[model samples]
Target: MTTVAHTPPSGTRHTVADDIAGVCEAARTHRAYGEEHSTLHPQVWEALRSSPLPRAALPKHCGGLEWGAPHIVEAVRVVAAADPSAGWAAAIHAPAGAFLARLDPPLAKELCPPSETAVAAPVIGGSSVPAGTTAPAGDRMRLQGRWPLVTSAPQLTLAALAARTEEGTRWWLVPGTELRVEDDWDAVGLRGSASHSVSCDTLVPAGHSVCLTDPARIDGALYRFPLYGLMAACIAAVAEATAERALEAFAALAQTARPRHATGSLAHLPAAQEHYAAASARLSAASAFMREAAGQAWHDAVRGQVENAARARLRAAGAHLAATSAEVCQSVFEAAGAAGLYRSSPLEGCWRDAAVASRHALVAAHGRRLAGAQMLTGSAGGHL
Candidate 1:
């Protein structure tokens, strides 16, 4: 499952897809192991480590590819099509580099040194919720709190946690070793994400904290892109790709699967054909909408004028994609009949993954409501 490093030559254009092309097969081959063990397979993890996806969103100076939102979403889709859990982990960890840009240049560079190895793009995991508290401790800060749903916790090199301080809610960059990881992620779907809870009660350098309200030190459109919109789009991309894979699995199953009490294969049934057609069309439309929305936001960000309207559109599209993808997966599952109910069935896994992904707060009803409020009243009264 090991893949040769595919770092492009200087002055040559390379894509996230090209960088991760070799890992897709490994992802497919080890998906079951991850699902069974509740963590990414070691081979797949090694392949990913060799790839540049972990630092795709980082600035070039920071030893990253600095990919745009649309590109990142496409990469996530590609990986998810191979394995939904892998895709979920990629989506969760890929954009973390942006958080590092909030720190001062020296500290940011020190934490993410320029290297020709995976250490340059360390795997990061944390929650945005202010579930912890921080206090001034002379020359340092004492941070204490428990954050849940820390994806890729077991492999994180650095953690980006949010805690409330006297100033306000700020993000802290604590070494993974300082946190106590609790292996408690037992979700039915995305079982391999390793999204366990992490708690920290250690003193960190005073310079480790960053107030998101402050302007970003890095100068780039990728850094300017709306954080919430980017996260929502990434999650939606996973759901969309998972649904697409489910449809493909159902199509393969229909070719040889015979319906009970029927003389012909499942593909011969008009109902099954209709369901497949409808699901495929819906998924295609949803995927297109998601790309368009993310692209528009990125364009605005590049121009240094990301309007609230653009953010609203992206958020709304993300929510729509999540809902549509879940529906499409369910439709494909139903069309597969009892054949899709087995635990080994890929369609069943897609259905479960989509169901769980749709429940994510970023792409939930609340986001859609906020988007609608902004579009109608010109004021969301909250972050879009």
Candidate 2:
């Protein structure tokens, strides 16, 4: 019953930079879709399905392209410019191929055939941010839990989750049909992303879940790979892209449309030029650092860096760049003022998405603490 898709040729490889422009151009032309496209836009889904990188993360054993984090970053940057919510979904789903790759061969084949994109949704309710209890019932596991902030819940066909049992937090997988997505993600930003809560009060067969590791040993190369950190880094990298586009938009505006307070032309003003210069540098620096960190962590992973050192670098780089990206957006927004806050302005949504999504518990201050503490105590950081 599993249907896997085949891989595209390397000659057809689409890098991050290429994808960034693609998403940006898409967003540029289809900005209105952000408000009404998730359910309505079949073309959007088709455009995403065509991306080579999302399928690249899977291992060669399963017929996946199996590209590393650099490709991952590129794909993310591509979608980042288009829509953060889309990028965020890609951040979770694309990289999960590695986790999927680790599954028992039968389990991997059963759930994901070959070449097909399998969606895994993590719900955010119960004690488990993405918690659900699965007991045997018929051909499936009886699922019971609520997952709030389930990013891209509507679009997903799989849910990778944890449950509270007699033992502890256990992971399970629920098919998309078994779950119900709540109409609750009416937030200030990323509205296009249906990151709603999912009601998990149904049956999900055991065949759906992949038990990758014990909680104690979950600290393997997979866990150490900095999933959360990468998520944050992707968010930040996208924010940087948003800032870049906003600047371009603003530059276009300044060239023709005079500022209300400025005399004569807007671009000629010293203060405006300074603002543009400063924001640009911040974005450039943050992006360069993020790319470096992603590259380093990936190289280290391939080279067999494990548990501590590899993760520490990933966390340090992810957290630092993410934080910097947020700051750069903030600085640019200041220059943009009320016009940037217009409901029609992409900056508004990008800003809100950047702030709201980056606040994820994994990417927050505690993550930074773990990075710093590990750096001091000589323990591998929790990042890996």
Question: Which is the leading candidate under lDDT?
Answer: 1
What is the TM-score of each predicted model, taking all chains together?
0.92, 0.80
lDDT tens readout by residue for model 2, 237-330: 5555556666676676556545677676657777768988887787677667666666667666666554565556566666666666666666
Worst 10 residues of 2 by lDDT: 118-127
Report the lDDT tens digits of candidate 1 across residue range 1-384.
Answer: 011133456856665567678668888888888778999898888777677678877666668777777777778778887888888888877777777778878888777787777645787768888998888899998999999998888888889899987878888999888889999999989888889999999998889877654556888898788877888888998898888888889999999889899889999999999999999999888777877788788889999967889989999999999999999999999889998888767888888899999988889998899899999998873377
How many backbone clashes does every candidate have? 0, 23
lDDT for position 290 in model 1: 78
Which lDDT values do the candidates have, in the order given? Answer: 0.83, 0.59
Off by over 4 Å in 2: 1-28, 36-40, 115-130, 134-141, 165-168, 203-226, 341-345, 378-383
TM-score of 1: 0.92
- Model 1's alpha-carbon lDDT is 0.83
